[model samples]
Target chain A: MSFTLRFGPVFEAWRELAAGVWLTLQLSASAMLIGLLVAVVCAWAKVFGPRWSGWIVNVYVEVIRNTPFLVQIFFIFFGLPAAGIRLSPDVAALAALVVNVGAYATEIIRAGIQSIHTGQIEAGLALGLRPVQVFRLVIIKPALRAVYPALTSQFILLMLSSSVVSAISADDLTSVANNIQSRTFTSFEVYIVVTLIYLVLSLAFAGAFRAIDRRVFSYPVAR
Target chain B: MTRFPSRRALAGLALSAALAVGLSARPAAAQTVDEIKKKGVLNVGMLVDFPPFGITSLDGKPDGFDADIAKELAKSLGVRANIVPVTGPNRIPYLLTGQVDVLVASLAVTPERAKQVAFSDPYAGIRIVVYGKVGAAVKEPADLKKFAVGVARASTQDVSLSAIAPEGTNIRRFDDDASAVQALLSGQVDVIGAATPVVGEIEKIAPKGAFDTKITLREQVHGIALRPGQDDLMKAVNAFVAQQAASGALNTTFRKWLNTDLPELKKPAI
Candidate 1:
């Protein structure tokens, strides 16, 4: 019933929410860094490895994509302890995010590598380039350029999805918002402030990725 | 360019506008207690899994202390009690939206909560209790200084723990009490802080002696929360509680749901 806008205390709440945003950024960045490593190996396996290896990657992607993120988080954070592998919330949340994002990135990077026509590989061979060099210089870099936009978007989605970790008790922005609302009893206002903070953080992440894209793929390529 | 309005189009627009006005006006008309009684339904909100206090049973029926009270309140008013299941963070929102006429959930009567909703007389007394790892011997709140404590999001226990938490203590929060229990069971945290009944429920769910009881932080009153400005409805509920206490019917209802003897039930605060 008390609808007066308490901007002073509300701003104090926003400050706490800012701290949560920092934690969220830390979670998303680390997950993406680890996810990038997994994506590279998985994409490479699907592209040049044995038939069974490709099937393994396919199953991993399908299973992760099919189940809800909430279930996957519970299985890692709650279910793992029963089998004696107990992990902290930060570690569990990070592992879940990386596994979930890696699957999506695998498909995107695989498509980019596959789109490298047969003639491109043959041309590299004709130029006396080794298989590894051809992969590094031609297949990998250009394919990366082709999928840059998709990868950036996936990372942004990963940032957004990281909000779910609040459920597992990661002291991230959304979880902090819950605490602040309980204290201030300003539920709607608290969520609105948190939403705007996420918007700014997402935009900042997109800008940083754009800068990285320009530095990594200076070559003229498009998909 | 202007499009010509047909007779049928005008009629359709009028009907839709009238429907919108009618739906929006429902809550406004429902402001009075007599109107809510005339509608023959008393909407009540409760969490879906808070056992002994409020819960959605395996058969999908509400089965708990608050659930029983809702039913009794409805019967007293000669209306059906329509229960609205809510989450930890959504209880106040449900009340504000007029989705439920009363929130009979295990809601702590905090000053912050009082600002958003009016509460009837306190029905239950609750305290925040801490449960540490078995054999940890954390005797006091200050004893947790060297260890991490876990709690649920947006809970009274969270508030109490944070207020008196040691400077270097690590306090982790989960979405609900179940997850906090999971963290404690998994050894992710050294202690779990929550309501007393919740700690009891956790013991029932987990292995024997998995957790040891610690200090109680603060005692608080739990009340049936109503939307702000619903004075008449508040008065009616207060009167019913008073009559029930005088007739000893409230005590019977409490024993049936709580399954324990609470001497406090004999004295209805109303």
Candidate 2:
């Protein structure tokens, strides 16, 4: 079972691997940002929009939640081309990730939006805040604060899930590992290294989110 | 304190002995044939959508060279063949984990793979060809350094591409021929290294005059893979191949799948 592991090729491909990690981080960050926006819009629509709009949003979330991410990725990558909507591998993978993550985010954000006490809305109205303004300042911020941890966790999961994009040839971290392992015939070794790198990235993201949480909810500690 | 610890220590020792005995007494896993005979089904792992090798046809049934081989092999063993699709990265894992007995997924017998699994004597010889953009500068393996290359992930073609492709050649690896071709057609890569049939399939999907053939990378033998130490299974497979070759059934099967008469694959010494 023991074999000499080749470190030369892995080291030589360090630049490519770094580029892949950078790409994965960029993809995850961009998708999370865009997914957050989509989540907000969908959550708001469910809470305040017409009955039909709520139904549509619910359907979107349900379908996405029920289906596997692999199938969704396949549909976007393979199905879209037939429908005359083609995207580059990176664009396609990123688009699929955003859509998948946004659905999960929608549920998380909606729960937060619902938890906003009726008293807050009433206070906003009393102060002559417009409906939109009340929703933005009074409801949105506190809801976001309460659900920030869960939402950030989902974002981290999305970052880790970005490994699947390698199937579509996005040249992300896992793809680089695949190439390295095949060349070196050290599949287990390559995966172990990749898992370590992923752990580091996860910790980094967690630290970043903690910093953001402190800055955003700087008013006081809730006892 | 020592007096009380003695009883606890004795209990811990007894527990540890029981655990060790229980673990060691576990039965060894049965072989694929043994399980198949008991269950009355021979499970076969294959590539579900790779034409000419293994594929699930439009009718929702498995077909192709590997599928046919599996069916015949199972019939010889007096068990019904149950086909299961497997991707390249997963095939070996599935075989080792007993998720599938044998992987007839056009698995090439490499020295690296031979360590973890047993391969039947070569039943087919797969030719690796490089398809590049027509009039492209890559007319040979040496030219691959100057051009970007795409290849199916974990395929022999990928190995060849990595070896022959110059440093910084930007070799893009996809999970299948389809995506690799997609990359090539989109100009993401200037060349695609794959099996001859795969290259043919890619050229069909791409624009007119999109593909040009370069040098062949290794047209080595391919074999069905089983878990290592499956001596009985190996002997059975080799016997089947030998029988098929003697009966000229091997050539017929080749023609049925590849749609061409490849005499080289008409069952060599098994």
What is the alpha-carbon interface RMSD for each candidate?
1.5, 3.6
**How would the docking of model 1 be graded?**
medium
lDDT of 1 by residue, A116-185 (tens): 8888888998999999999898798888888899999999999999999988888898888887776776
Question: What CA RMSD would candidate 1 show?
Answer: 4.2
Model 2 Cα lDDT, one tens digit per residue, A1-223:
1235656667777886898899999999999999999999999999988999899999999999999897788778767777778776799889999999999999999999999889879999999999989988888888999899999999999999999998778889998888776665566567777888899999999999999988987676345
lDDT per residue for candidate 2 within B1-270, as digits (tens), equals 455567889999999999999777543333746666777777788987567787778898888888899999999888889888887766776676667878888888787778777888777767888888886776667788877688888878888777777777777688877677766766666788878777656656677776778788877677888877778877888999889877988778988777776546433333
Model 1 Cα lDDT, one tens digit per residue, B198-243:
7777777778866878888877777788887889888988887787
Error of 2 at B55 (Å): 0.8
Candidate 1 residue pairs that clash: none
Candidate 2 residue spans exceeding 4 A from truth: A1-21, A45-67, A75-87, A128-135, A192-204, A218-223, B1-43, B78-82, B132-137, B142-148, B182-190, B200-215, B265-270
Q: State the DockQ of every prediction.
A: 0.59, 0.27
Q: Pick the candidate with the highest TM-score.
A: 1
Among all candidates shown, the one with the greatest DockQ: 1
**Model 2 pairs in collision:** none
DockQ of 2: 0.27
Docking category of candidate 2:
acceptable
